[model samples]
Each structure stands twice: as C-alpha cells, then as structure tokens.
Target: MHVFLTTERLGLRSFTDADTDDLFALDNDPDVMRFINGGRPTSREAIREQTLPRLLRDCPCLRTRSYWAAEEKATGTFLGWFEFRPLDDHSPAVVELGYRLNKAAWGKGFATEGSRALISKGFTDLAVERVTANTMTVNAGSRRVMEKAGLSFLRKFTGDWPEAIAGSEHGEVEYELTRADWQQRR
Candidate 1:
C-alpha cells in the first residue's frame, strides 16, 4: 500500500480499487452515515461508480490524491479516510480538511492526531495558507476534534442541502486555521 502520511498509530494512504468493500461497510454503518445521510444505506454500485472515483481522483494543484485511506499503522486495520484537498484546483492557498472514521475508531484520539499532522504538513510543506473544516452544528464530536487539532471557530452558516438531515435546522459551522495562526501556536 502506498502510504501518504502517518501518525503515531494511524497510516493514511492512497485509495485503491481493493478498498471498495471497506468503503461500502464504512458508508453503510447507520451511526457513521447518520450525520452525512440520515442513516441511509449506500449501494455498493454507488461506492464503486461514484465514491471510489472521487476518492481516487488526483488534485491538480497538489498533483496527488487528496483523499487518503486511513488505517492502523501496526495491524493495518482500515479505519476510514481523510481529505485535505485544495478548494480551487489550481491554487494551494486554501484547502479543506475532513475525516470519516469507522464506528470502532470513534472517541479515539486518532482523529485529532491525524488532523494535526495533516494541518502541519499543509502549512509547512504544501504551500497551504489556510485549512478549513465544516460540519453540522449538532456534530459536537467533530467540532471538538477540530478544536483539539488547533482550528478556531470561523463561522456558522446554512448550506444548501438537498435533503435536510436531523440537525439541519441548527445549520452548519466552519472552523479554520491560517498559516499565521498555526505558526503562532507552534
């Protein structure tokens, strides 16, 4: 497996065709899909046709895959994935950070650890000026992880969701860490 990044206990690597089954299981989990799709089941066809292609796509600015398959570094267990893609295909000035780990990995420090590593890499190596993340306002767990990773609350806004989920009424929140802010923190 081509590893892209690694934390103390987690490895982030490029997604491959072999990951179809793992992606299916992660998306099919009710708890995992709750905030994303209101616990709806994702068809395997969709994973192969849509999701996998997106995950495997290369970012023009970075000239590399932006979404990574995360796994346990030691045992190589498939955890989930992380995205640190540039918002604009041609510019590395701003990127969006995201993570989706399996239920088994929930509440573990893996999220914070991986997030911090990605942010540090973006600011120090990728020419990234800012890193941003967003989630539903009710997603306290995700928000906490963002905070722990050193991002500060930027704003709250309503997104155009085709199908509003359970906590859509409360809107969404954004958190960000600029290169300057990250440098100061260090």
Candidate 2:
C-alpha cells in the first residue's frame, strides 16, 4: 500500500478495498454526515460497489496523490480521509483541500495537522500555485480548521443543492492560500 503523507498523529495513505468498512462507518454517523448528506446514512451497497472503488481509483499516489485515507499513526486505526487534488488534473498547479474525520476524532487537531501537512507538500513539493477549500458557511468547525491551516477567507457563494440542510439557505464559504501567501507566512 502506498503511504502518501504523515502528520504528527495521523497517517494519510492510499485507500484500498479493505477500507470500505471504515468509510461506511464514517459516513453512517449522523453528526459526521450532517453537513454532507443531512444526516442520511449512505447505504452499504453503495460503499461496497461504488464509494470504495472510486476512492481507490482516485487516491493512488502514483497518479495524482489526491485522495487519502487518514489513520491514527499510533494505533493504526482509520480516522477518515483527506483530499488535496487539482480542480483539473491537467492544470495541477491549483488544488482543493478537504477532509472528513470521524466524530470521535473531532477537536483533536487531526484535521488541521493533516491539512497543514498537505498544504506544505503542495507548495514546497508539488509545485502547487494555489490551494482552495470550501465548506457550508455554518460549518464553523471546518472553517476553523481551514484558518488554522493558514488559508485566508476568500468568499461566500451559493450552490444548487439537491437536498437542503438547516443552513443551506446561508450558502457556503471559500478559503484559499496562494503559493506567494504561503511563502510570506513561512
């Protein structure tokens, strides 16, 4: 298995077929899924047949080093996943950063740690020009993680959604960090 990146307490690795159960459990939590699917549990069949396959296909380090399965390095337990890939693979200088951790891993700095590491890799190693991330405007927790990872608030925008959550009417917020900005911060 290809291990992509590692944070102080988390290991980001390429996802494999064995990760289906861990992904299923993470997606099944109402609190974890709240911002994603409005607390609706993803079906097991979808995970087994679709989700895991897609993750495995997209996350290989050899191709893009995009999606990653986050694990607790100390215990080797699956924490969740992180994504840092270009909006278009053809133009890899601009990428988007994202993560989804289990509720159990909340408030532990894992998100920020993993994010900072990925952003560092993008700018210092991957020749990334800019990194962007977005979340529901009401998702203060995620927004905080973005801030702590050194991204600055960019804008708020509305998107067409098939399922409306409690804060969907408020739109979403975008945060970004350019290579120049990252260099200045360093």
Candidate 3:
C-alpha cells in the first residue's frame, strides 16, 4: 500500500484500481453526495471506466497534483478521500485542499484531522505557497470543516457548474491559507 500520510485516526493513501468499489460506495450515498451531486448516484460503469482509471492514474503523492483515499487505520474502513493538489498541473506552489467523507464518518473530526495534516505537510514539506478550497454557500458543514482546517474565508463567487442544484443561486465560497499565514499560526 502506498501510504501518503496518516493522522490520529485516519490513513491517507494513493488510490488504486482496487479501490473502485469503495469510491463507488462513497459517491453513491445520498447524504454524502448531497452537496456534490444533489444526491444523484454515479453509475457503476462510469466509475469502472472513468473515475477509477482517472484516480489511479492521478494518485496524489506519486504525481504531485492528485487525490488520496482516506481510510480508517484501526479497522481499515474506507472513510472517503482528501485532495491536496495544485490548482493546475503546471503550478505546484498553490495547491487546493478538499475532502469528501462517508456519512458514517460525519461529525467525527476525521475531515479536520486529515485536512490539517495535509495543509501542514503541504506548506512545510511540499513547498506549497497557498492552499485553497471551495464549497457551495449553503454547505455549512463543509465550510465548518474548511474553517477548522485553518483556511480563512477569502471570497464568495459563482461557478460555471453544468447543472443547477438546489442552492446554486447562493453561489460558492472560497477559503484559503498561505504558507506565511500557516507559519504564523504555527
């Protein structure tokens, strides 16, 4: 297993083709997918052919700009995933921090723990200058996680999403933490 990082209760690892089922299950949950897809489930075929291949090919630590599967250490249960990657493949200095956790892991501090760890690693170890994240304005839970992860609110803006969801009219909020700011916090 290619373990990228670990926290008190979670292990962040590179996603493999074998993680397809876990990713599918995480995406299929209505509550889990609520903010992301308006509760729509991803089809198995799409996961098998597109999502899985894309994730494996872009495993975070291996390729700089990619995703990491988050798992529970003790039970080896798949919680979800955390993304700590540059805004673009060409720019390694400014990374984006994001996470998606199973509904079962909600309210358990796993997101904050994993995210804080990533931000620390990014600024201190990966030479990341800034880290940013975004979520719909109505996603209070996610916003709270961002705040707890040391990212401060930067702006509220609209995005060009393909489909309109329930709270699309409210726009999205952005949060960020710079390396200097992180150093000050530390």
Best by TM-score: 1
How many clashes in candidate 3?
0
CA RMSD of each candidate after superposition: 0.6, 1.6, 1.7
Order by lDDT, highest first:
1, 2, 3
Ranked candidates, highest TM-score first: 1, 2, 3
Q: Which wins on TM-score, candidate 1 or candidate 2?
A: 1
Off by over 4 Å in 2: 58-62
Best by lDDT: 1
- Higher lDDT: candidate 1 or 2? 1
lDDT of 2 by residue, 24-100 (tens): 99999999988888999999999999877767766233255588999999999999999897887576688999999
User: Candidates' TM-scores?
Assistant: 0.98, 0.95, 0.95
Q: Give one clash count per candidate, in the order shown.
A: 0, 0, 0
lDDT (C-alpha) at residue 29 in model 1? 97
Candidate 2 weakest ten by summed lDDT: 56-65
lDDT tens digits, residue span 88-157, model 1: 9999999999999998999989899999999998888889999999999999999999999999999999
- Residue 98, model 2: Cα distance from true site in angstroms: 0.6
